[model samples]
Target: MGENKNIILALVLSGIILFGYQYFIAGPRIEAQRQYEALQAEQAAIEGTENAGVIEQDDAPSLPLAVSVDPQTDQSSSGNYTYADAKTIAINNAELSGSISLGGARFDNLFLANHNVELNGEEKVQLLVPANEDNGYFVRFGWTAVDASISADDLPKATTIWTSSDTELTPQSPVLLRWTNAAGIEFLIKIELDEQFMFTVTQTVNNTSGNPIQVRPYGFIDRKQEPVTDGLFVLHEGPIGVFDDNLEEQTYEDLRDADGGKFESTTSVGGWMGITDKYWMTVLIPDQAKQLAVSNLSYKASGGYRASYLEKAASVPAGGSFETQTQLYAGAKIVETIDNYQDEFGIKLFDRSIDWGWLYFLTKPFFAGIHFLFGLTGNFGVAILLFTVVVKLVLFPLANKSYVSMSHMKDAQPKMKALQERYKDDRQKLQQEMMAFYKKEKINPLAGCLPILIQMPIFFALYKVLYVTIEMRHQPFFGWIQDLSVADPVTPLNLFGLIPFDPPAVIAIGIWPILMGVTMWLQQKLNPQTNMDPTQQKIMAFLPIIFTFIMARFSAGLVIYWTWNNLLSITQQWYIMRKESARRAAKAANKA
Candidate 1:
C-alpha cells in the first residue's frame, strides 16, 4: 500500500505538470502569438500603403557590402518591384521550380515542386519569396573589399544588374552571371543545381586592374519579417547552424534581445548557417576547408532578420584571379535527403535541422525504424502500427517479468487485506507486516510501474518523430485520416462533422483518443489495484479519461500507437494473470 501510494502520487504529479503546462503556459503563449500576429498585420497594412514594396535598408554589416544610408536615395528601395521587374534566369528541375534573380544574383524565388501548400491543393510550397514581396525572404552572395582602395560603391550591391550566360538553369547545365566595376575588375558567379535542393555557387573575382586587391566572399539569407512559428516548445523555428561542429539554435526573440541584435561566431574551419521553419529551411554552407565567420542578426528598425557567413579574405593579384565556392540548400527537410546531403557534402550535423528533441538517441532510431517500415508498407500509418509491434516484441522479456510480478501481487491481495484489517489502528505494524508479506509471497509492489516508465521515453521519441519529420506531412492513414501528422479531424463533439457547428479545439475529442482511453482502462483493469485505497483507485480510474482529453490534440499517428500498445499490454497481462490464477487453483486443489 505504501509503494502503491507513492506510485499514485508520482502519476498525479506528472499529470498536474502536463496539464498545468498546457493550460497556463502553452495556452497563454498561443493567445499572445495570435495578438502579436494581429498587431503585425495591422502595422503591415499601414506600411504597405506608405512604402509599398520598398524595404528600408539598415546600416549593413561591415563585412558585407554597405547599403545606402538614406532609404529615399537607395536604388534598391526604388518603387514597387516584383519578379517581373527584374531579369531572371529560370530554374527548372524535377523537384524544384523557380527563377534566380539576375539583379544582385539572388535566389529570391523558389518553390518545392513535389510539395504542396495543402494536402489537396495544386499550389506548390513556396520556399523563397522575392525581395519585393511583403514577406521578403531571399539568399544572396557577394564580395566585400578588405582594401581601402576598393570602395563599397565599387563592389556589387543588391541593385547591381548581372548578365546571365544561360537563359535557364537545369541539372545538366549551370548558369554564370557576370558584372564589371569601373575599376576593371570582373565579378562572376557560377551557379549549379542538383536534382534535389542543393545549389553550388562559385564566386570569382578576376582582377584585371593593375593593382592587387583584397576581398572576402560572403552569403546572407535575409527575412524581412519574423515568421509566425508553431510556438511549440518541443520544436525550434528560427536561426539554426552548426559552427565548429557544434549545433547552435537561436529564436527570433533571442536574436532581438541580443546585444545590438546580433550573434557572431568565432572563425570556424567549416560550418553551415540558416533560418529554419518547421518543415523548410534555407542554409548557406561555406567551403569546409576555409576559415569563416557566421552571424545571426536581427533588425528591429526594419523588422528583418539575417543569417550570414563571411569567408576569410583572399588576395587577388594583378593578372591573377581569386575564387571561392559555397553551397545553398533551400527546400523541404526530408530526413533521408538531409542525411544524404550530410554524407555527400560533408556538412556537419545537417540532420540536426529536423529538431529531433532531447531524446535524439531514441528519436532518431525510432524514426529510422518507422521510416524503413513505411518504405515496405507504403503507408506511414501502417508503418507506425508495425513499429509498435516491433517495440513490444523487443521489450517482451522485461514486460513478461513485470506482468508476472504484478500477477503475484494480485494473487496475494486477500492476505494483504487481512493484514490491513488486523492492523487497522497500527500504521507501523501494517507497514512491517505488509513488507514481510510482500517478501514471503515474492511480490514486487512497484513492478506495475515498470512498464509505464519504460513506455514514457518511447512515447516522447515517437511524438518527436511525428511532429518534426517532413515525410509524415500530408501522409494519410485509412478512411477519414487524410493526414496523420495532424490531430484527428473528426470529433464526436459535432457528430463527426455531421452537424454544421464546429466545436472549439479544447472540447474536440477525436475517435482515436477515445479508443486509446478505452484500451488504457482495460489494461489498467488487468493490473494489481487491490493494494490501493478507494480514493487512489478512483484517481487511477480517471487517468485514462484525463489522458484521452490531453491526447485529443496530439497527432493521430501517436494516438493510434498508444491505443495499439495498450491493447498489446492488456493481452500480455491477461495471459500472465490467468496462468498465475490457474497455478494457484491447482495448488489449492492438490492441498484439499
Candidate 2:
C-alpha cells in the first residue's frame, strides 16, 4: 500500500514539474523572442529604414520608344484573340522588374520560370520576377501597352553560360507562344485574358537587323526586393535545375529571407486556379549575352501588382532569335490546388515557411513520402496504416526487448510477492532487493515507459503534420471520418423530432479510439509486473482510457497509426509470453 503511495507521489510530482517548466521557463523564453521580433518589425516600418514600396523591376525605368496607330485597340489579326506580328512586345505595366503584384491581397501570385533553349552550344541564364504588395508591379489591371520591344541584333555576343528566365507574365493562364521568322524572327503569342487583366512583353526584337539566331536560355525569379511587411513570411520553392551551383539558394545574396520565409511546392495540371496555388514566369533567350538583367512582379501605376520591361543585348548571327514563355498567377494559397498539382512551379505553403524547430525539416520529407504513397490509393487512412507499419518495424528490436523483460517478471511474480509480504514493514529494503534482482538480471525498471517516451515525439510530429499539412485538410478516412483534421461527433441536446445528428468528428460511430484503447489494455494485461502495488496496477490499467480521450480529438490518420501499433504489440507480446511460459513449464517438469 505504501508502495502505491510512492507511485502516486511520483505521478503528481511529474505533473507539477511539467506545469512549472511550461508556464515559467519555456513559455517566457518563447514569448520574449516573439516580442523582440515584433518590436523590430514595427521599428523598421516606422523608421522607414527601407522603402516599403520600391518595386524591383521599376527601379530603373525602361526606355520603351513608342510607335502605334491606335493605342486603345488590341493589335490582333484574328478578330480579338490573336496579336499582330510586331517587333516590340508591349507590356501594360512599364515597371515590371523582378517583383510580383499579388503581394497581400485575396489573390496573390508571383511568377518565375527558367527555360533552356539549345543555341550553338548549351548556354544558361536566369530570369527573376517577384510579386508582393511592396514589390511586384507587373499585374496592370487596366492600362495601355507600355512599349517593350527589342531586335535580335540588339543583344551582345553569346556567352554560353547557364541562365534562368526572370520574367514570364501571363494574365491568369499561360499565353500560348511560338517563334516564327519572317524578316529576322517573329513570335506568335496567344494570351488568355480574364476580366481582371492584360499581359505583354514590354519589348520585342526588330528582326529587320538580322536572321537565324541560335538562342540558348534558362529562367530565374528576381526576388531581391524588401518584403511587403516585416511580419509576413517568405515562402520559396527549393532550387531546381540541372546546374549544381545554380540550385543552391544560399549563394544568392539579395534573395535570402533570414526568417526562412521561403516556401515551395509544385503545380497541378490543367492550370486550375484554386485557393491554394501560385504561378511562375517563363523565359527563353539566345545562346548567350554580354549583359543580362531581371526584376520583380509589381504594378507600375497606383502601386499595384503588375509590371513590364525589356532586356536587350547580344549580337545575333543574322537570322538568329530566341523566345521564352510562362503564366502569371495572382492568387491565394489553396491547398487542393497545390497539394495535387502536377503543372508545377513549386509553390510553398505558409506553415512550411515557418521555423518550427527540428520538426519542420524532419517531418517534411516524411509527410511528402507518405502522401505520395497513399495519395495513389486515394485513401490517406490506408497510407497512414502503411506508415505505422514502417515505424513499428523500425523500432521492433526495442519493443521485443521490452516484451521479453515483461515476460520474465511475470514468471518471477510469485517470488516478488513473497518478498513484498516478507518486507512489508521495510519498504526501503524491499525496493533495494527488487533493484538488486533487476540489476543482476540486466533488466531496466523503466523498460515499459521507453516505448511511450520514444513515441511521444513522433506522435507530436504526426500531430503537426496533420494540422498544418494542406494535403490532409479535407481528405477522407472511411465513411464517418470525412475530414481528418476535425474532432469526432457524438450526441447533443435534442431540440425536436427533427433529430439532429452529431458532427462527423463527434460521432462514436468512429471505432479508431475504441480499438486503440482495447489494444493498449490487452498489451498491458499481457505484460508481466511482479510484486506490483495494487494501485500502480490500477493506474497502469486505466492509462489506456485516458489515452483514448486525448487521441479521440486527433486526426483519424494519427489514431489509425496508434491503433495499428497497439494491435501489433498485442500479438507480439502474447506470442512472447506463450513461449516464455512453455519454457518455464518444461524446466519445472525436468527438475521435478
Model 2 worst lDDT run, 10 consecutive residues = 269-278
Quick one: how many clashes does candidate 2 have?
A: 125
- Residue-level lDDT of model 2, residues 186-226, one tens digit each, is 43333343322222222222245443343222122223222
| TM-scores for the candidates | 0.91, 0.46
Mind giving the per-residue lDDT tens digits that candidate 1 earns over 1-592? 4655676578767766766677677777878877987887798877665555443342233442332221111134333343455688999998899998876788989999999988999999999998876678998888766657476677877777789769999999999999998989999999999999999999999999898888768888888877767667779999988877789888988988888777676556778888999999999888877777434444444678888777766888898998889999999999999999999988888899889979999999999999999999999999999999999999988888887886777677788889989999999999999889888888787776777678878988999999999999999999899999999999888888899988877778999999999998887777666655688778888989988888888899999999999998888777877887888899889999
**Candidate 2, residue 449: CA error in Å?**
2.1
Question: Please, what is the whole-model Cα lDDT of each candidate in the order they appear?
Answer: 0.82, 0.42
- The CA lDDT at 251 in model 2 is 15
**Cα-based lDDT at residue 439, candidate 2:** 78
